[model samples]
Every structure is written in C-alpha cells, then in structure tokens.
Target: MEDRELLDQLFSGGDASASAWRAFLQKYSNLFLKIIWQFEKDRDEVMEKYVSVCSRLMGNDFAVLRKFPKELGLKSSDFPSWLVAVVRNISVDLHRHSQGRRRYPKALLRLDPIDRKIFDLYYWQGYSLEEIGHQLDLRKNGKGTDVNESFARILRMLTRYAPRERKATFPTSVPFNENMFVPDEEEPRVDVALFDKWLEGLPAEHRLVVRMRFWEDMSAVRIARILKIVPQHRVYAILQKSLQKLRTHVERNMASN
Candidate 1:
C-alpha cells in the first residue's frame, strides 16, 4: 500500500494497517534516517529524537502531532519551510529547560552570537518579542533598535528558514548501486559524483526533508516537533512530495545512464 493509504488506514482505526506501515518504515529504514539527518546535530541526538518522534506518532494517538508544530503566522508555501523551524524551536526549548537548574543543555554544538542571544531570550530567559525589543533599544540607542529589528527579523526568518538549516550537512549520501532492500553493514561503496549531482537538482526544502528522513533516520513525530506548529498531515505531505520528486529523479537518472 502507498504511504498515504497506509496512513489513512492507520488513522481510521486499523491496527493491522498501522503495523504494516511500521514494517514498511523499518524495511526502508535507511530512507527514514536520511530524512532525520537534516535537523539533528549528531547521530546520538538523531537516534534519541527518532525514537521520541516514533513513540509519539505511531498507533491511534496523534494528539501531540495534531497540536505540535504550531501554526504561527505562516502562509501555505511556508508550511514545508516550517520543518527545520519547528526542530530549531524544539532544540532551543530543550536547551532552555535544561539550563534552568544550571544543567547542561542537550545541544551538541555551540550557538553563534546571534543564535545565542536569540536562544537566551526566546527560550532561556522566556522573554516576549516586545520585551526583547524594549531591552535591545536600551542596550544601545540605534544599535538597540537594530537588535530589536534583528530579533523580529530572526523570528520571521526562522519561520521560513529552509536552506540555511541544512547548510552544515556532513559527508553522506551513497549511490544506489546495489538493488538491495536493506543496508549493508560494511561500507557498501557506490558512485559519489552521480549522487552529488542528483542531490544538486533537488529543491532545498525537499532536499532537507530527504536528508533528515532517509539519511538521518528521524521519525515523523520528531520532524513534526522540529516543525513545532504544523499538522502531522502537512509534514507527511511534504515528505511524500519530496519522495515523489526523488523517485522520479532516480528513475530518470537510471533511464539516462
């Protein structure tokens, strides 16, 4: 069955269909990992986030998925853009809550200057935008105003930050040489140049989704969390669309070569 049909069967109270979908995901586990890698900072976090997302999303319960990835001031096109947005917000929130009791944040990487400030105020300090704006204006006359505007802009930019999220991808993506259903334990080497060229043709947002879901092995629930305010169906749709594009790309590439 197709992913959407499987989802419908599961969502409409079919336990067998849900189990079938789970098996399908497990069978194509590598593809799911690729999808997870886009947002998670490291393999450890990726595993943690994936398990968390899957636990929340599977079964007949989609309450959290429904409410999470909250729909802020977003346009229809901006919905897919919200994937990384939601994940960043979740990371920030996780960081903040950890730091409250002087505990170490779960984040593996150090935030940059701007990200640090934004993380502090928005998540750690629990300050509102208007409040942040007021404080920025006080720190330095015109500079403070700029900071305020920057803060607002960052919020807006984050809402639509697609390409910037996956700018730090590590060396991944092996070629589809062997037509096997499962991944090889050892380095099953393949053509790197062809894979790179294929990756270049993908849309940024679609590419990010593919990397996260397929390469990184992230779960849809975690994806939903990162995209904090979006509906699960929306996230699923984005992923499905990306997969379709990728499937078509692969088919054409195979045909040509």
Candidate 2:
C-alpha cells in the first residue's frame, strides 16, 4: 500500500489494529536497525535497541505516531524521512545514556595541560566557546575565532587518543504478538558501509555539519547555536559543500569500479 493510504488508515481513529501499523514496522524495521547500528557497533546491542525502538513506537496505541501533526506541511511521502529522524534521535539518546554508565578512561588524563583545561572548561564547567575564550584570553580579533580553533584542535586530539572499548553483549528478545506483520521480502538496502567510509573521509568540520544537518535533522539555526556561530547561512553553506564533496567522492569511486 502507498504510504498515504497507510497513514490514513493509522490516523483514521478506528480500532488500533485496523491500521497498517504492523506493515509499517515490517517495512521500516531494517532502516531503524541501520540507524541504531551506527551508534552501536555490537550486533547484540543493535538488536536490543531495535526492539526498544519498536516498543516505543508500538506502546500506548502508537502514541509516538500520533504526536506528528497532520497539518505540519508534511506529506505522506515525507513520513519515512521524518521517521528516520526520530529513530536517529532515539539511537543517539541511547548511546549517550550507555556512555554515561561507563567508566571514564584514564586516557583523558593524558591530554596536554592546555587542552585538558579547555576540555574541562567546555565540557565539565559547561562554559560556552565565547566564555572559554574570555577565561583563556583567547579572544583574538574580537571574534572568539582563536578559542574555537583551539577547542576544535583539542577535540581532535582527544578523539585520536581515546582508548577503544570492547563491545558488550546484552540479552534481548523480540516480543511476539498476533498483530506483528512480517515483510515478505527485504527492501533494497543502502550501502551503509560505503557511505560511512566516505563520511569519515570528509574534513572534521564538514563531517560534523553533515551529521548535524542530516542525521540529527537539526535546523541550521540550532546548529549555529550549538556551535556558537553567528548566522544560520554559514551552516547551510557548510552542508552544501559537504554534500557536494560526498557526491563527487561517490561518483569517482563508481567510475573506478
């Protein structure tokens, strides 16, 4: 069935089982698993999170689906993209929660004295880049550019030197229900491995912008606010350039093959 027909059936407010909810799950479950796998490399953890996402969407008579406004200028065709954004947010939240429970590695202590100070001020002290600039006397040329550059450098160093942790196993099983609908055939899947490889090859700033704009579904204004940058247009420019680079990379690879 078309997405529009399926959506109509869902929001028709008849019996809950009358809708295409089961079909919806079967169609999109793979996509959800793909998004979760990005943050969770372990197969077991990915499966666990995938089940959790289904539970969230299925609980309370599809409360999450009901939250979307019908008049929000979203068409039925936009549903998949919108749902992907929702899954991405949930996956990111889960990743953060799990990370919080893990022990802080001693590798953090190995940071250079100055980089450590900057890291602490920004992350631990909750200071914004502009504030950190003032505290560190890095407000060169009155734009806080120096502080931003320093913070980026520190981030790169920390990411490079962070100790890798082994994947943990978790026991999780999908619940059985009569209403569960399974797809007859698998949908064509994206080459996620190739895409991830290309994404990682981009410049750090470009990669960050791409993830924020696409995966996180963040507005340029919101991204600018988080990055302490002025004007949303800068974020848009970054996204455009980054996407162009990615497209070019893909084309070159395809030609070579």
Q: Top lDDT: which candidate number?
A: 2
The CA lDDT of each predicted structure is 0.47, 0.61
Off by more than 4 A, model 2: 12-19, 69-71, 98-257
> How many clashes does the backbone of model 2 have?
0
- Which 10-residue window in model 1 sums to the lowest lDDT? 102-111
Best by TM-score: 2
- Expressed as tens digits, the lDDT of each residue in 1-257 for candidate 1 is 64434445545556775686576456444643455565556899777766554554453465433433355665434533353454444444443543434212212022223433543454334455566545433334333224454454433333323323433221122222222112323332333554455557777765665566544445555666775727755556665565345446555665676
Point out where model 1 deviates above 4 Å. Answer: 1-184
Cα displacement (Å) at residue 201, model 1 = 2.6
lDDT of 2 by residue, 1-257 (tens): 87777666776666754547777877898999999988898999999999888888767877777766554888777888888988888888788855543222233334434444565555444466787666665544554336676676644433322222312111122122222222224222234655577678888877876666554445566667888766656776676566456556665665686
